[model samples]
Target: MACMEEQRAPGHRWPYGPPWRSAPGGAEPGRSGLPWRSTLLLTLFVLVGSRFSAHGQPHRVPLDGSAHALLLLACVPLLWRYRHPVAVPFVTATAALVYLAAGYPYGPVYLAVAVGCLSAVVAGHRRAAWASVGLLWAGHALVALWLYRWLPPAGDKGADLTQEIVIATWVLAVLAVAELARVRREQWARERADRAQAARRRADEERLRIARELHDVLAHSISVINVQAGMGLALLDSDPEQARTALTTIKAASKEALGEVRQVLDTLRAPGAAPRAPAPGLDRLPELVEQAAAAGLTVAVDGEPPRLPPGTDLAAFRIVQEALTNVVRHSGSRHARVHFADGDGMLRLRIDDDGPATGAEAGGSGNGLAGMRERAVALGGTIEAGPRSDGGFRVLAVLPLHTREDE
Candidate 1:
């Protein structure tokens, strides 16, 4: 985050204070890297502009070599503004005050002070920057109000209190400009950080979606294939006809798994492209039942599934699929039950299986339950999975109908 603030914004107007930290590729349009061009231009402008202002204010002391040197001292510190923010403002302010006391004509000599002060403020040294400019103004007010008699260009009368208004305005203008630059630079930084954080959050959500898709697709299909392969091998010679039916189930399960896996991979290949096939929904519950039957488990689905948002429908399908897969893989009883109903804009799902503690004998990564919970939470829903008191495993999910995810 610290490094974030040092980089430059693409097209911010000010050059002294740092803005957005985009790639510093060869000095962007509004951002400067070394600031050498602007520094040189500023110094030259002060020199030339002062020579003209002095001619116009003849009563003031002329621009001699000493006055030129003091002006140079003030402007040169600006080159080191970024590296030495606090020091630069004081150096420039000191020079401005010394030049004023010497009676050099008031002119563009203040521009250097302004730049240094703004740099300090933008660099997060607000107190130091304010104090530096305050010092210069205080010193100038003293000289112009009382010290004029002892100062150079001897026959001078002290300035009236009314004349202080002009000086006050200049100081006010510098402070206002510095404060504005500080605020705008911070705003750019906040916006940049927010954009970066948002990008990361979106990436995390995508990874999760892919994980759930892969897990649900692979877990359920592979479970069926595992059962059929076992059946085929056990009865390969003892009952050749039964073995053939098992092999055919294996073929169909593998082909469907491949298709679904390929569909998932397609999403990775071309994000934001429409899915090649409609996502599986509760309407495919019969297919789920058939696949379970092939695995030697009985699946009975009760109650009609209602029309739902695509996200909700997909979640409902995945949850039911995962539950039935768990039953086929982990339950001793070959019968599983799935019940779903819609009421008051909510969809309720319940899956149950007769069980007698498969425990360590059942092999699974244990991510299915968590995945179901994630799906439910994303749609403002909930999932509860555990054992029933009557020696059965149960998974219950309550999903919302009005859930909306950004397209």
Candidate 2:
């Protein structure tokens, strides 16, 4: 029962568990957990080592049946190296030490110890890797001393020096390769995380932009519709012709609103589809003034708008539209003036109404003003809006044309 419980413990499985698994989700059945390819390669190394030992290679220690079993014990644990990176190196190193102490032949069985060291480093077990290296060097020195005292010399001093150099070079190379792989994996993960964050930020900005569009389109249209409907109802019994005209204005405004709304929805639903109409810009200001006049607000234009970048033009139009809508719905203004000017590489817009400030203007949540400010600021511009001291409300926006051109 204790054995079963140990196996079931998180990250403490004897053969495989939490830290052994690749990342959060489980790895493919044969690819990660089982590692059949590595098993096959280890098997090949064992076979080759056995054959070389049997043929009396100078470097190979002769192996009896018990030494052969010890060799298998050292190498077989490598199958679980990835699952227990730190543990695997310690187990293989201990097995190799036992084999060496028992005077078994040093053959390809040491390959398992090298692989475990590499695995520990790649698995981010830095302390374990250093410990394994220290243990390996200490064991090697002790074994050499034991051989010098108890066994006949197989080679000269020069031959022993060359072998030591080669073994040290091999160990350093394994560590270098594992460190490089870990660095590369970490870099890739960081880059993937950055890309995901950028995508989410762009998505949030797009949602805000779409919301602003919908609010401007719907709010302005519904305000006009409400005014016209009210006028029609007030005049229904006395001025039938004027009432019919008001109803006609309402119908025209509603139809235009529906079309604009559908266009925005189409662009949202099918981004690759052809646009139903060009976005509103400075050139559409005349039509906007007409719409306001028809809705019973007398609007006057001061100067002609210069040609502008698409983004700036769209932003300018929305700013004017939102400001005019406020004058009509909240300002209680009969007359409003829109002034446009281009000078000093900046396009300037000023809208003022000769009406008393309403409660909505002073104490409202100001989503419209906030949205307009966001749009202007996004284009590297500024806007100021407040109730005028003389008698009314005013909004002024300054946009940099040169900045748009440079972009």
Candidate 3:
């Protein structure tokens, strides 16, 4: 049964086009023996074409030993057909034609003609393939007819016609099969390229998401704490109690923010699949405020903030952080107030500081304010920041806390 299966199995595969791997910085083999495979198949045709030559024919040319040698040897370099399909086929076909013209019997050399036809097809030259097929058919028929007319074997009169038709059909069938395989290989290569491009795009998007998180969470928090610490230090001699409280706030805010940053990094670097909790939102606002107060920015809260969606909560906190940071930097006032309330289906947060407002500083365009505005806009919200005519800077942000349907 194993032997039977082996017999049924197709022969070895031939590499086409170029060798997939080769010594670097050196000349490479062109075709992957596909042309040789075709040559072997064509050698079979030679056997069939030459069978009738033994008949008592008057004009049949005896098979020349040298011509048979050329036919068998021509396939050696033709193995490079894919690497140099056009060049290899041209050389092989020219050699075969010379052999045929030199009175080499058609019997052993028909193999070379068949391989030339296949080389053209595998090279993806439809025009050349068709021409090669037509030329071989005509050559075989002309040679057979030559022998039949002069050296016709006395017993077999009509057999040559059948042999000619059979060889022609076999050549066509081989060409069709080769074309099919080439098309399939091309399709597979295209699909691989498309998948590679999609994977690159996904990687870029993932990096951008991480960047946003690092900027909004870690950078914004650090900025606010730094501002408050500076103000507390400035007043240390006049208000030692306030300075101590500011240092305490700095420590707490730093520790909490560090843990959150680490959690985000751990999830990003996880080796395999692992679930992670959603990011902290407005539910953690009290803790955020406490940390800020510890840093020496006397913070006041009023009007309960509504239960907000996850994204809105994050945006609200970022807005507050940036506003308070600006207060610590420019506001001469010692107190900052944060107010949250719900009105008209939106959650509003306002951070007000008794900061000096001049034409140069009022409605200022800074990175902190810009980042805050970007977060608000991304969530389909709006922010307003300017001098409150009463000599303080105010930042106001409004965001939808529920879906359109819920509203």
**Candidate with best lDDT:** 1
Q: Please provide, for model 2 over 1-407, each residue's C-alpha lDDT reduced to its tens digit, 9 standing for 90 to 100.
A: 11111223355333222233244222323364566677678867875786577577555456667776777787787787777788888888888877766555557777778777777776788678767766875676666644545543344122265566676677778778778766755565565566566657766787788788888887788878888898999999999999999999889889988998898888677755767799889888888888899888989999988888888999999999999988888877789999999999889999999888565533233588888999999999999998889879999999877554656
Give the C-alpha miss distance for residue 128 in model 2, angstroms. 1.3
lDDT of 1 by residue, 6-33 (tens): 4445785543334332221323235555
Candidate 3 lDDT for residue 216: 60
Give per-model TM-scores: 0.90, 0.82, 0.59
Which lDDT value does model 3 have at 197?
63
Best by TM-score: 1
* Model 3 stretches with alpha carbons more than 4 Å out: 1-68, 94-138, 141-173, 273-278, 291-407
lDDT of 1 at 98: 99
Q: Arrange candidates by lDDT, highest first: which order?
A: 1, 2, 3
Q: What's the CA error at residue 57 for candidate 1, in Å? A: 1.0
For all candidates in order, the CA lDDT equals 0.85, 0.76, 0.62
